[model samples]
Target: MPPAKLKVGLVQQAVSDNDKATNWNKSAEQVAKLAAEGCECILLQELHSTLYFCQQEDTDAFDLAEPIPGPATEFFGELAEKHNIVLVTSLFEKRGSGLYHNTAVVFDRSREIAGKYRKMHIPDDPGFYEKFYFTPGDTGFTPIQTSIGKLGVLVCWDQWYPEAARLMAMAGADLLFYPTAIGWDVNDTDEERARQHGAWETIQRAHAVANSLPVIVANRTGFEPSPNPADPGIQFWGQSFITGAQGEILAKADADGETTLSVELDMSRTENVKRIWPYFRDRRIDAYDDLTKRWRD
Candidate 1:
């Protein structure tokens, strides 16, 4: 039997400063538009309801985080049901008092959250101080079952880890979706910026090739100022994109613009490409004991 095909929409847009209501409304408009255009699934950028505010460690930002079935998920649930489409969204989840996580929720067409994946690799790099805010995800590498198909959902930092990708693929994910909020550090040299962006894109593309599964990456755009006046804020290079099983770029956006990229995937291509490449079949799983260690040394 031929593999099923589905139309997926990726919303690549810039977010405002700490304006949750506006951001949610903007995302809803885009979702509605995509549904009208006949898309079966829609993916939004990471932390779509707020700016990439992790640049500074402020106690106030924690207030932005809400419960899973709280206001944001409820809003998305209604939208999913009204549009009759599966929705993928990333949010700051308030698991409990003083405990929060960067989570991606998958809503089936029935408007209910089927499953969610909390980001595992929380980066504490200079401008991206996520560790101070997000508690590392405890939800293991598992695919979220949806009306469209199984969704291998991961957050921004997790995208760089091969183990994360491999585990999801091994768990029978039909496609991988990455909701990202990455940006360029303005203080870096031009060459440094180019190298950083290139590495980021290359790593994720390689994941698609290795897994022989389509990958969708939705990123935010525009320049957001650092809440702290001392440091320069990051300039987000949108360039959201989608890649096929062979790591071919199907669609892409520009550096600073709002774009909704819709692409159709031949879900069957995964099996065909995997058969020819056989990366999984030739894996040295038995010899990979060191992968569980924090470091080889």
Candidate 2:
């Protein structure tokens, strides 16, 4: 069994451009900082390699994609092996010609890819046109086994769904990780922005509570101007956080700040909490057959 206690860290930052090297270096600096601080596992925000190009649908954005064993996996993999830490990273993956995915790659204390989880949910809202760029992940909700524990890595939009979290928990994930890039429309009122951010944090915390697992999330910060001149750009809210099995906030970075969150999580708590809560033990698996349908109507 993995150790009962493990130190975890997260990096939140602003992506100013699509220059992959600069962004990776920026993330690398933070990873080194966290590792020096004794973090055994670290997470980087979603698509930290480039600007959130999903803001618009353009053929040119496809140029941003790269293959799995390509540049990104190698760079971050080295850091993982050097620091002797399990690193979870997100990137835009080019699987083949005209085929791409918003994917999360995990490296477990080695300069080799441990596992990968593709973003299963593709959101298609204004200023967040993801469906145009990504193919829905065929990799089911699976945990990436590592030196520390089992990490259930999910991407940005997948955070909104309870089903995704539950599936990962059922698959024996010890920690749930969200390498996210969610933010508010800057034009929305302060109240609206507050509500959106609140909902975002609340849902993830609830997942931790329901599943008796720790939750770690990393989100980008700062405002990125819209590619189209007429639009008000998105404010990538940077409130990355780590929460315990009971939904207690352990460490969190404030909104609009470029920071790292680090804390030691007690893996044993999952066993104790689940023994008391026993949500899985009491579930009625036969009654929810309609969950796969588009809607009950």
Please report the candidate that would top TM-score against the real structure: 2
lDDT of 2: 0.93
Each model's lDDT: 0.90, 0.93
- Top of the candidates by lDDT: 2
Candidate 2 on 100-183: residue-level lDDT in tens?
A: 999999999998999999999999998999999999999999998887778899998999999999999999899999999988
- lDDT, residue 121, model 2: 98
Q: Write the per-residue lDDT of candidate 1 for residues 1-297, one digit (tens) a residue.
A: 223888889999898667888888889998999899888899999999988889999999898899988999998989888999889998999999999999999888866788999999999988899999999999999999876778899999999998899899999898999999999888889999899889989999989998988999999899999989998998998989999999899999888888899988888889889999999889998999998899997
- Structure candidate 2, residue pairs in collision: none
Please identify model 2 stretches exceeding 4 Å from their true place: none
Residue pairs clashing, model 1:
none
